[model samples]
Target chain A: MDAMQIANSIPMWVACGIPVCLIIFQSLLFMSKARQASKDIGLSDDTVKKAIRASAITSIGPSLVILSGMLSLLVTVGGPVGWMRLSLIGSVMFEGIAAGIGTQQVGVTLGADPMTPTALAMAVWTMVLCSIGWVIFATFSASRMEKIQHKITGGSTKRMGIISGAAIVACFSSFVASHLIKANADVGFYFSKNAVAAILGALFMFIMMKISAKHKKLSEWNLTIAMVAAMILTAILPIGA
Target chain B: MNKEQKTEYFENTYMPKMHRYGKLIGVIGVLVSFIPPIVLAVVFKAIPDWGKLPAAFLTGAAAFGFLWIMEPIGYFNILGPVGTYMAFLSGNISNMRVPCSSMAQVSAGVEPGTEEGSLIATIGMAVSVLINVTILTIGVILGTVVLSKLPAGVVGALNYLLPALFGALLMQFGIKDIKYAIGMLLYCCVLYVLIYLGVFSWLPSAANWLPIITAVFGGIAFKLIVDSKKDKAAAAAEKKDE
Candidate 1:
């Protein structure tokens, strides 16, 4: 093979480079904010760092395993349609995990990534893995702080109450409506991206609210709206993506 | 403790450590990006490649972009363990093509009936996925079971629920103008219609990603332009009122 051909042939590095970059970048950004948030909230740094480190370690094992799978597919079952399908699963799972069990509780969405099940499954394992560390940190570091222990909780119970009520209403409403019925899980990729974007924006607003002391109900309003919208998206969208 | 002591204790203790942890997380994140594909390539028996990077700048650039975008929206819960797990799984399935998060758009060699290791890995990944879904479904079902007990006409209530949640979330700081929301919605509908009609079939490769071509991109772009105009109008109105 020519130099170029030989070089291009090693598809794994070339292909995954962007996503990995995005992931790492995402992780670092998360870490930084977590730092700011901890400081802002008056939590101990070592605890937060420990949580992040534990999370990172827990996260990587699966990522590499998945990476191995992707390489196998590249050498086996390749195409854009398949790749798109994979992205569907990848994006949701990624977002779902980031959001926590609150997301996990939301059933399959119509617009969910075509691979939602896979993503969801990964999310379960992630939760399982991270919970171990979360418990450890909670037991030792955050023993005194009742509020902070639930940091990774994702408020699953509350979010479910909100999303399910919304979805049931939506579903029944669709049944009654003449034209605008509830479509099957039609979560487009853009929706996920937008959701991520909104969630992030709202997070900033929430942080700002906590730090400022002058709690603007408007920001709380923003948080509520964002969470609900995210839930609706979570509800009506998909089982796969 | 006195108020002064509280402030001093907080500033002296909490903030600095969080900052340091944040940096540590950032540095670790930068380092972690380079792993998955490398490991995967080796496992798949393919010759691992020299990727597009090895350049320090690449890592730095990646670090910057990720930090900026993620910092704004995250409470770190945004990086939920579940999402990462799902990502890893997607990576496994896409292994049939490319790894999850891989930049590769196409993996030319793959088709049905390839290598045993690859296929087995794919199947194994699939089974693992089924297990994951079961857990999530249980979560969903349990949630729905709770919702089932709520008051009647759930549909109508939630009709406003989405918008209500949106309003609550932004504290009414939505894409505030009804016109913009409608415009964005219409653009989405129309694009969906045309794309559904197969107009995209006629477009060239370049045109494939055309604003009119990709439903989401084109629609969002149109919406952004309209929203900006709306923003300007609102600003002008405020100025005039003042």
Candidate 2:
């Protein structure tokens, strides 16, 4: 069979699925362990369930984005590789660039032509080697990070909370600010749909939090409501255009 | 078990299990990650020549090598230990995992970096993984047929969804302390402005790094300022009491 055939074959799909299965298994294992730990620690089931609900709700938007990215990749590498990679690693940009380089090395462009088996092999090796660093580092040092946080906070849980909160704010502000900065570049009454959507999203969330304070079920849906509201608003407004 | 022993058991007993699972997953993940390509190459007998290997690996690594180390270092605190293991394997740490963990902790009303917060974060991450995998599996199975039928405008709108979620996420955390959120936002804007004006032209790579640079430095500076003010206030109160 040709490169495309192999990439799309059932065997290739199964091979790709092995790691995905491993990921699911590991996540299930960790989830069970965490649930038990939380119980042992006397953590209320209500809180745990709330977290699960909120996280699962919050994930839908981002997962859709990944799905979109996966479809584009499907055109380049066949269905199985794209599905497996996006399902497991879920780094679309890195995988796309790596695959491009693989094709480039063989004097063939990735989407432009059929990939040779040699080109496919190189792509796999490159993507694996480049992305392995995270697993390696996390394996050795994941446990040590709490100590580092401890030292930073001087054993103060309050201070640790502040630091964690600040780090999160800083990290997210960078992305939001980048979009806002670009939106503000026009200097007039002009705004990009992205910036408007972002503002609307935050605004919607703020409102949700206010309502949820009095009526608690709203908290679980805060992320979903905000995201969907912003997306719908962007579609209807024509503000960015 | 009581609180102290629970903490000890978690750290002593649960933590070792986490490490064990982490390493097992990591090793198995690394080995299995190579299967798709390895199997294809073997089936077709399409292994590339040895001479071209180094360049192939280096070319891809060069693009993202920095993030491989920096992401773990940068995000470790937010994710904690168990979250970290799952996040690296699942990917999308910044966009998905961090938000999930933070939201989980906040909703649970637990302070991050504590045992309760760590367990909650791990649970949040694992749920997210399961949800994501389920959706993607369905999408992959039926993606081309379904997605192809959707309007381009609708699909285009989907792109804005992530940015929207990010904005919402910021608000979720920012509501706890509006002052710090505003401060960090302003700092990020300044970095963006400086880069936009070509002030950092000589350091071209700094533009791409503007966010992270701003985050680390801005967070530290802001923390120091806040701490010093607290100290001053405490001292003044003490003197008044004296």
lDDT scores for all predictions? Answer: 0.31, 0.78
Best candidate according to DockQ: 2
lDDT of 2 at B121: 90
Worst 10 residues of 2 chain A by lDDT: A182-191
The DockQ scores of all candidates, in the order shown, are 0.06, 0.67
TM-score of each: 0.27, 0.92
In model 2, state the lDDT of residue B118: 84
In the order shown, the candidates' Cα RMSDs to the true structure are 20.1, 2.8
How many angstroms is residue A124 displaced in model 2 relative to the true structure, after the best TM-score fit? Answer: 2.6
Error of 1 at B143 (Å): 21
Q: Which ten residues in a row have the lowest lDDT in candidate 1 chain B?
A: B100-109
lDDT of 2 by residue, A1-241 (tens): 6776767788888888898899999999999999998998889999999888878887887888888888877777778878777766557667788778776887778878777777777766666777888788876777687676667767665676666667787887877777676624466334567787788889988888888889876777888888889888877886874
Best of the candidates, lDDT: 2
What tens-digit string does per-residue lDDT give for candidate 2 at B145-189? 786777888788887887788788889888777888888888887
- Candidate 1 stretches with Cα past 4 Å from truth are A1-241, B1-34, B40-175, B204-242
